[model samples]
Target: MDVVALIGRILFVVLFLGSGFAHLTQTEAMSGYAASKGVPAAKLATQITGVMMIIGAVMILLGVWSDLGALLLVVFLIPTAVLMHAFWKETDAQAKQMEMIQFQKDLALGGAALLLFALYAKLGDDLGLTITGPLFK
Candidate 1:
């Protein structure tokens, strides 16, 4: 069960870890896309959020302060979905469909992060293989 939990955690954070690395390494290209989407200080925002995603992924993967890591993901996902995947603003049918898909994916991930946050906050002691446990309690 502990091993399973560890594997689950690893799988859950994989997207974040990879995407976070891209956010840092592909800063210029990512920031340009972000600017096209009207993100202010796009470069800085990309860098900061990259760090957030990487730190959050590491925390969750290591089972240290997993709740805080989840919160970081929530913080990153919500705004990104709203700002970057504004499907309603798209007029092209295919583009709108793609953006909507991205929006939904982001929301789904955000919801999962929220559940993780709650799990650690309410049941940290019961969780298997944790290091420092939830930072909240």
Candidate 2:
């Protein structure tokens, strides 16, 4: 692995893992935040999002089932950007600005996930994993 890709993966790991921790540790607060966006039982939303983020982050970091991993992140972040960080229209100028930035970040995260999907087939390709009879090798 070249230094740059390795660094990119590390950054990906840090982001997803850190977000998972936030969801896990601050469930109640996040749940309240969710409720503010019209989410029902925001507390439950926190737990679900936390668990999902952890699973996805672990898979990506381990380079196992990474295509699925990216898919999970992509799916999770859409609702997150739309519901949790909603910035569509807000009269409170300051609050709107913050929410807009948050939304943009989530959108960027989602885009990265899609990029992962596009790049999935080449992942660890240099490692040469193949299925064959022992004699075939």
Candidate 3:
């Protein structure tokens, strides 16, 4: 069960980890797109959230302060979905569908993050983990 849980955590965080890397490596491109979407302080927001995403993923992966990590994801996802995936603002049918899909995906991931936080809070002790901890403690 522990192994399964570990694998699940790894799988869940892969996307976030990859995204963080992308944000760091492709800052100019991402920030430009973000600016086009009317995101204020686009580059700064990208860099900050990129770092947060990496930190959060690491915390969740190592089961160190997983709840806090999940909360970070929730924070990242909400504004990201709203600002980046505004499907309703699109007029092109195909573009709207694509944006809607991305929006829904972000919402689903945010919900999962919330669930992870709740589970960590409730079952941390049982799992020999702590919801709040100094990394890997």
Candidate 4:
């Protein structure tokens, strides 16, 4: 069961992990797009969120302070979804659809992060994992 849970955690974090890598590797391109979207300090924000995503995903995968990791993701996802995927502001039909899809995806992921936090809070000890850690303390 622990092995299964670990595998699930790894799978869940793959999107964030890959995205974090992309944000770091493609900072200039990503920041440029962000700037187009009126994100202040676009480059810095990109880098900071990238680091947050990587750290959060790692913490969740290791089952160490997973709640904090989930919270990090929730924080990153909400504004990101609104700022980056403002479908209602799009005029082009196709573009609006694409943005809407992205928005929904982000929302779903955020919900998953919230659920992860709740689960960790409730079952962390039962799962034979340390939910509270030095970071959380």
Candidate 5:
């Protein structure tokens, strides 16, 4: 069960871990896209969120303060979904569908993060294979 939990943790974090790296490494390109979406201070915001993603992902991956990590991810996801994936703003049908998909994806991932936050808060120590218990409790 512990191993299974660990594996689940690893799998859950892979997207964030990889995307975090891309956020940092491809800041210029990502920022350009962000600016296109009307994100102010796009470059700085991109860099900051990149760091946030990496840090949050690491915390969850290592089971150290995972609740806070989940919160961080939730924070990142909400604005991202609203500001970046505003499907209603799209004029093209295909683009609208794509944005809507991304928006839904973010919402689903954010919900999962919230669930993990609550889980870690309730089962901090018993979660197994953890470096430290959840930060909240």
Candidate 6:
């Protein structure tokens, strides 16, 4: 494996894992905020997102079918932006502002997931494998 690709995978691991930890650590806040966003079954959505983040993080870190992880995250984030942060119910100025912020965050996460998908092959090349690790093959 070349040095640069190794670095990229390391970066992927760090980024995903950190975000995952953030999700796992902030469930109550997340759930409350999601409730404000008018999400149905807010608690379940929060829990699901938290778990997905942790799982995605670990998958990226372990190099275990990280492409799939990336894809799944993209799928999750896109609907999240639309459903949880959509402007329909955000009549108040502050709520609208918060919705915009959340939408942007979700969009950014989706973009990051797409980038991971597009770059996974290069990453694998650098890591000397087609998947995250030996068992992932």
TM-score of each: 0.97, 0.82, 0.92, 0.92, 0.97, 0.68
- For candidate 4, write residues 1-137 as lDDT tens digits: 77777788889999999999999999999999999988999999999999999999988988888888988999999999999999999999999999999999999999999888887776774544444542332
Q: List lDDT for all candidates, in order.
A: 0.93, 0.73, 0.87, 0.87, 0.93, 0.70
The backbone clash count of each candidate, in order, is 0, 0, 0, 0, 0, 1
Clashing pairs in 3: none
Residue 55, candidate 1: Cα error in Å is 0.5
The deviation in Å at residue 55 for candidate 2 is: 1.0
lDDT of 3: 0.87
Candidate 2 lDDT for residue 38? 91
The whole-model C-alpha lDDT of candidate 4 against the native structure comes to 0.87
Model 4: lowest-lDDT 10 consecutive positions? 128-137
Q: Which stretches of candidate 3 lie over 4 Å from their true place?
A: 128-137
**Top lDDT prediction, candidate number:** 1
Candidate order by decreasing lDDT: 1, 5, 4, 3, 2, 6
Question: Model 1 residue 105 lDDT?
Answer: 98
Q: Model 2, range 8-64, lDDT digits (tens) per residue?
A: 655786887887889889888877777878988788878887888888777666666
The CA lDDT at 28 in model 5 is 99
State which candidate, 4 or 6, has the greater lDDT.
4
lDDT string for model 3 (22-103, tens) is: 9999999999999999999999999988998998898889888887888899999988999999999999999999999999
Cα RMSDs, all models: 0.8, 5.2, 2.8, 2.1, 0.7, 3.8
- The predicted structure with the larger TM-score, 5 or 6, is 5
Candidate 2 local lDDT, residue 124: 39
Candidate 3, residue 19: the lDDT equals 98
Clash-forming residue pairs, model 1? none
Question: Compared with the true structure, what per-residue lDDT tens digits does model 1 show for residues 1-137?
Answer: 77887898899999999999999999999999999999999999999999999999999899899999999999999999999999999999999999999999999999999998998888885676889779986
In model 2, the Cα lDDT at residue 2 comes to 47
Q: Pick the winner on lDDT between candidates 1 and 2.
A: 1
Residue 107's lDDT within candidate 1 is 98
Q: Write the per-residue lDDT of candidate 6 for residues 1-137, one digit (tens) a residue.
A: 54565466567556556655666677778788888867888878877876786676666655677776777678778988898888667789997998899899889978987887666644544553335433222
